[model samples]
Target: MFRTHSFVLLALMALLVLTQCTSAPDRSTKDPAEAVDVADQELSLTEEKSAGDWLQEADAAANEVEQHSALIRAANAFQNEHQWQQAAAILSQLAPKKITHHSQKYYRLAKARWAAEQKVWAKVIEELEDVATQFNQREFRVLSLQLLSQAAYQQQDYWQSLVWQVDAQRFAEQRNTDTVWSIARRIKQSELPQQRPNDLALAGWWRLVDYHHQAMTHPDSLTSFLNQWQQSFPNHDAATLVDIWLEPPLKPSESELEAEQAPPEPTLAVLLPLSGRYKQQGQAVRDGVIARTGEMKNLRVVFIDSEASDIESQQKQISELSPVGIIGPLLKDKVAAWSAQPITGIPQVYLNQIDDEAAQNSLTNVFFALSPESEAQQAAQKINQQFPSSKSALVITADGSSGRRMVDAFTSSWENEQAEQPTISYFSEREDMKTTVERSLGLTDSQQRIRAVKIAAGKIIVDEQERSRRDISAIYLPGNLQQTRLLKPFIDVSVSPFAEPIPVYASSATHELRNRLGDSDLNGIIFSDVPWLIESSGKNILLSQWLELRNGWGLSLARLTAMGYDSVSLIQRLEMMNRMPGLVWSGLSGELHIDNSVVQRKLIWATFSKGEITLAKEADNAGSRYR
Candidate 1:
């Protein structure tokens, strides 16, 4: 058996980073390779193994006439062989299984019953602690704790899941501590109030700083999300990262209640990239921001090119003007640089994503509103929730930044959501994703046939890629609308286990992609998005604001009016929740949730067909899906 501290840490870290080990087999061998490295290996599950093995063997003895081993041994054999009925027969004969087996028997019996009921995960974990007893199988007991975490997670008991995760992490030391810290934070983030940008930001930071170390491509995908997150946590620095990319909200202190009594047109600062490759995007944000100010009485929105401003220079310029609040600095580097500068305390909301310093310091009074990678993760979570029974496959673009981020986020999130904290947070490119998953699930055979593909995806995977595609349920992830639209036709053509053509997606879908992949192409497919189109069933509490913006500003705004209106409405609500004083938002996206930790609903599901989106239901904000 490999007794290297590295392997044990490797398994634990994997659990912490990607949230792994929900349904692995109890191969029971000390060697990780021979036996599935399940959560049952934790010391907490183990104790004085009175007659654990004896009872198990006794259970196994019911069907096999020749084999004679301890009770636990018999039980394990029967369970491994999947002779549930026979195993139960022996367990039924045991007395007070827990105490008799030194607190091992009932636990294993629980496993037997759970397995018999087809609750594979629940059974394996429940049976492990008692069977592994501390004095006899300390490692196994610890593994049980880990497995318990996995079981809680898989069963959607996130709070309990985190408790177990915390317990198992205590034994992890030295090199394993990072994993423990990271996973602990991840569990905390999982408890986010909503999928909003603030929530997504917390989620993103965990996946990156502690795991992948960077955000996704096409950072614009999270624009609406960050805005929403900001609303939840108006003064939080988590919101500031994205706020750095955009402009700060009108400072309420400056625009005091006096404006309402004798309202003057409020001067809103619009920061954007007026002279850069991102000119189009900047213009989009500018137009959206301006279009947003239509209803506000005291508002005179000014557009400033964030690219033109140097860190210190822009600070001086903005302070001189004494604008209501400032926004923009769009790029991460730019935002971080700007954030590092000590300046006036006017509330600033950057359009860019969060910076390392800001996130580390947890700065106050800053609002961040966008984070593309986090948004994709939220989308992936929704996919998992929507189809808990179906596993996903990825058929992403071989190239492109958007493709890379989508493939990474979806693939990693799917596995993490499936496993009990596997270290799949490094699932960056398609190849990296393939290798990580194949190794975890033991898809050695599949790693082979797809040699060239895996190489292209960027990994020297020794596993069999061909066999992998054959083993798991998969999703086809095209990172862009174009990629998604282009890939839709090939679902039936590509090879994977799920007989039916599975859900297809990009992290986003613009009109262009929608126009291309009309109803037929989009049917049964899933995509992530903010609410742009209005449906009769959708409760438009922000309808008046949206109508006011459209009626006053030219209705020629991009599809972001819904988001802007929602953000304002959300902010108002948070302001109302003055007692909390932090961010507070919810019920804004399909399967998306947002809270103080984040701004936008983590995800909003959309389906496309014949150039139109067909989704209407938003996921409830109360579940672990947002967390």
Candidate 2:
């Protein structure tokens, strides 16, 4: 029995060797027989070798064809084990010309994958550009198209991304139609080609996105437009995604229709910290709510102290109140705690936002906050509108999480409209502000050059010492009032007198009405803030009372008060706004609108002039005004 088993094993081993020898040679090799012989010899000798061992063999191979085969085998071994770095290293050593034609396709694919991992998007595109169309395997074709699409999207070539994504949907087994639609949505309507592409799929995607945008503002026209679109692209891949794309409204049942028609309950439940360290803030919010609802005769307001007990107890109190809609929880931790739980079917408008995105999936909740990130984003848009000629910007921010969020938001918004990435700098301490500003504006580099020239000449020969960079057309200062006050003057003096004056923009954090004297240094700095505080045209009796008592409540608390007023005003309109995302409400906070269950505000634009705040005429006339 032992002799028979031995003979069977030896016979199987011989068959494996024969199979390896008879395998087809790489297409890249001119001499197919020689390449196959070399591969067969290497396979027989290195049957138990690791990827590392194969790499060493490739480096010490007798000739170029042997080395190419060894390197491709090493890369495949490393990639199978998910050793990305090792695979990338092995792929880098391969010479494309020495590789077999069959192996050359895989070599390009491996190199493109490595580039994608490194986020070298341009390199990914370059590596795959020629071979993408030549791939015969469905998996390879699908992967190539998907990688190219992602690389183009990362490079902000939206049109190319959409084209590639549309092409990918054709070959993929389970088509990601959502990904195709999402890439299409990123493109602006005005940027779409007036003449559709000859590719039917690409043209269909363009028209669908265009029709969706128009349907948002004029929803009644969607059905007719969709019918026309289907007739034009009846055989297109996008036709399969029509139901998901339209997101048609569900028909209401008898009870649901009656509930919608019935009047909402008059009681409104509010959660606030009436007795904790934040009692003063709670009181200010309460005052604002009262000020807004004072004249409403049929309304009953219920105030629950959120800090008095745990979140569970607070929720119990909210249940007992059974109010029409709810608002408050004037702290972040409280808001986050509330968000962690399931919705109770009652509508809520949170005074603060939480970090958990999944918690905000419900349509019954609204996140409304005076977010620094929101202010920074609007500041970017305002700057773009105010200075249409400016292509680049310099952003200086404080060093912390808040600063990071502000800078990220500003960069994303700025890049959407401009071709260049804004230059960014950060300062950790108040004393570092001046140096940070100087370095950001290139004054430090300018001075270093002057000193270099003076040292070379053996005397102070240069008349001019420093000059700000001419490339920066605008500056964004996302700092607090005191920080802005300290940094503005340094920026003012750092620029060379010969250069054009760069316009500076700021967030609401830099705006305050309490100190006109301190604001003198902030002259010519533009900022966005809630209209209730910045503009006098919409002043009410409640706002007047707060202005009279400003000394007691402080400016920060006044902003919170305005938030509370808007929360009450939004209770009845939240559903309507959610349904019609294009609708805007002129509230005390700003031009309020709903976006993905969050209240987005377009604030009033203002600039400092003669030590006093004034409405920017350019903002009012240059299409920045919401109305």
Candidate 3:
């Protein structure tokens, strides 16, 4: 009887152990306090440091685990300093593991905040959405939804934000919460209309509203888009907003009338290297100046030969003339040498850009160039506008100083304004282009496929797989027509399985789309250039007249003509520009903005279509007298 009792006790004990082992571990549905405790233990610091100092600590950390922990601390430090981008960057590199639920929620919320500060609205939405939906904790979920509403608003999904805001308010009200109710009310009152439509329909309506506003600057593009919008949404309420933007007989502004009435200044001097290697360029300018200002009454223009050999003597002679204003001395070296001295009295316009910082900073004279940088920057801007979501750019340029400068300038503008870094690859010879391009586009992955085939069966066979890297969204080719022609075909083949051609943007150097046969090589390349070069508008008529005056008018010569014409016209209004501080001279070269005696030109954009260069529908930024 005693043995039987012992056996029964042993069985009961075993059954109890099994029951405990098989049962689910209790999960706290509230705050993830264990995770927070872990993070606190890892990240605890005795003394506070500056954001920069914390960043250095994070960088100098001993191992990946320490580095990640230090990065989190650094991000918190940056948040304290309100340097959100720095914080976002520090957090962006960290991939922490073995954290509890509370730590994950805290880290995600912190990341979302920093992302919002960095204007990375998409990231903000993504992080907040994950926290709100995945985590069932009431406090964090409510906070996450509230943050999502604000982030969505910043992302320009106004109606979506409003919906989130409303949802947040309802959730808060059910939980007797007060934090989100006021926010929801404010958003509804200020942002939403009386009639609340679905989010998508509201989004479409707001787009039309934005287009209506954008039409003020880009009427031609707006007109084309509105026509398409009308066709697509004839019965929609947004369609009614189109005709107001499309009405004809747009009135001219006072500035336009003033510019038309503005007479050319009297007794201007012209400096050109009229008898040397630069004579063709000089003569083109002379012809262009003569073509435009030659027929004008009461404008005494004296032509001076600025020979390169005796630049000092020529400049001295120019100074001795003591004319109203000066133009030219087109050589870069001469311009630099001349601008080093103080010419406080006469306002001059140099044809090429001033590279010397002291010269650029000290002189009251204006410097303009047939600037490649301007075209490159415009190309970058156009690419960003066209492909808002695709930020990564790959630049394919010639292996030289010019190409480097173009890439640097383009990258500077793109990274600073658009907030994305661009990859650069250079080619020295046509023979090396294929290899260089293949490496840049990541099409070398095909070699791996070939190797796999060889290892399996000694040759490529049917159903062999290859894939190109999809990270690169656009290509910037700052090379001439031939290089572009050569590089593009290689890129197309490299990215074969992906049918859509990656958008290719080029500078004014690719303006070689004259003949259909020659242009077949440049079918889809977009480039930025002076309107005088691409379009046969009224400006081209003037260029045509200038062209007829000169023989063998190449593209470079034609550009110089436009430069000379605008230079002459700009000096006439130089004082006006200086005084007003917001006036731009609409010249053949571009819309010219002269600030601090430095001339900047914004070129019109164009793209090759069916072997012809066509003016892009979007107008240049049309703020009056602004760059």
Q: Write the per-residue lDDT of candidate 1 for residues 1-627, one digit (tens) a residue.
A: 334674455334322321111122432213222323122333132234422344433333322111122333444444544445445544554333122223343345445444534656656555653443343353444555666666656665554555555556544332243333333333333343333223432344333222111112222344455555556556532343445645655667755665567644445454567887876556655544654566555556666777886767666666656565565655667766766673544445555456354342322224445455665676566655555543444444445666577557655666333533312222355345444434433445544546667677786555442433432343545454544545554444444453444445455543342242245665656655554432331344354355454454322233333333333333323221221221223333322222332344444556665555566355444453223
**Best TM-score among the predictions, by candidate number:** 2
Task: Count clashes in each candidate, considering only residues at least 3 apart in sequence or on different chains.
Answer: 142, 3, 1
lDDT of each: 0.45, 0.74, 0.64
Tens-digit per-residue lDDT, 517-541, candidate 2: 2356678988877888777633555
Number of residue pairs clashing in candidate 2, backbone atoms closer than 3 angstroms, sequence gap of 3 or more or interchain: 3
What lDDT is reached at residue 466 by model 3?
53
Q: Which has the better TM-score: candidate 2, or candidate 3?
A: 2
Least lDDT summed over 10 consecutive residues: which range in candidate 2?
618-627
Candidate 3 deviant stretches above 4 angstroms: 1-265, 308-316, 416-420, 453-462, 513-518, 537-539, 579-581, 617-627
Q: What ranking emerges by lDDT with the best candidate at the front?
A: 2, 3, 1
- The local distance difference test score of model 1 is 0.45
Better of 2 and 3 by lDDT: 2
Residue 7, model 3, lDDT: 46
lDDT of 3 by residue, 15-119 (tens): 333233223244222222322343344442222676556545544543434334445666666566565555655555455562344456557777877777767
Candidate 2 local Cα displacement, residue 459, angstroms: 7.1
